[model samples]
Target: MIDYIMQYQSEIWQAIGETFVMVAISIVAAILVGLPVGTVLFLCRKGQLYENRVVFGTLNIVVNVVRSFPFLLLVVFLIPFTRFVVGTALGTLAASIPLAVMAIAYYSRLVEQSLLEVPRGVIEAATSMGASTIQLITKFLYVEARSGLMLGMTTSTISFISYSTVMGIVGGGGIGDFAIRYGYQRFETELMVVTIIIMIILVQTIQYTGSLISRMLDKR
Candidate 1:
């Protein structure tokens, strides 16, 4: 184990950093874009306080289109745009564009769903108290659904990590890149075992931490 780490220490560390960068950038971007999109969807959705057929229909279609594309296909289709934006369609940042794109779509729908679950009565009560649109949203929508939103975001985060392994196929370096290049391709089952174990451990840690934080924040 030490020998493997020693031989590839620098590379492994580099991959770890790249993976972290990918996940962080993706999460932040997703939240920023998804929040408003989801909030709008919730407001405009049928029977909501601010219901609008046009806005809701457009958002629903766009989000559906995004989610319809399989991740690998999305990555391939994004190459042209990725190259245009990043000057190369391979590497950490480039790989993350698709991941972030996917995250926004995936998370926006989840957010909409979460906000929808915040009872109509609660929103109506807030408005009866003369809450402004913003006030109602901040107070009623977010406050009521905070725990569910956290869990959904946590699920998205863990999911992206697993999906990121596919990026390694396109030369986006990470433990996935390492595992695929050295372990799978070269038929090093032991190396593959090590890498898979590490990924499992990482996911479990994230899940536990997220659940704890969600519980801590849950007033209900």
Candidate 2:
């Protein structure tokens, strides 16, 4: 146990950094693209501030279609696109390509759903006050949905972490790869236990931190 860690310390650390790169890039990208995509989705719904059935149906179908794809299949499905984008079908960076696409679809729906939970009266009041479509979306809808948005982000990010584990099958480097290589392949039980603990700790920390931040943003 200790011997392996001591022997491959640099390799393990490199894998950790690789995993972080994949997850971090994917999460930030999801937030940037998902938030607006979701906002537009909600705004286009029938009877909303920016109602447009055409736009609503288009975005709705797109998001739903993307979300409905099985993630593993989605990754493999996107391989040619990924190769075009990242210039390769393997490694941490290449792995992020699929994660970002999946995250965008997954989180966009969550964001739209969260924004929908804002009371209708608040939206009506904003509209009555001459709030433009953009104003209503950015100020009222988002403000009301802030907590849910945070929780949704936390949830999606954690899911991405889990997804990264499977990326290793494609040679995407990460802690999961480490566990699989050292623990499963080499029959190193202690190494597997340690990696499992690390994953648990990482997940718990993300959950607690997300809760604290969401609470701070919530006045009610």
Best model number under TM-score: 1
Residue 59 of model 1 has an lDDT of 90
**Residue lDDT tens for model 1, 15-96:** 7787788888779977899878999999998888888999999999999998999899999999999999899998888999
Candidate 2 residue lDDT tens string, 120-180: 9999899799998778878888888899999999998898898888888668889999999
Global lDDT of each model?
Answer: 0.86, 0.87
Q: What is the C-alpha RMSD of each candidate to the true structure, in Å?
A: 1.3, 1.5
What local lDDT score does residue 123 receive in model 2, on the 0 to 100 scale? Answer: 90
lDDT of 1: 0.86
TM-score for all models, in order of appearance = 0.95, 0.94
Report the number of backbone clashes for model 2: 0
Per-residue lDDT value at 118 in model 1:
84
Q: Pick the candidate with the highest lDDT.
A: 2
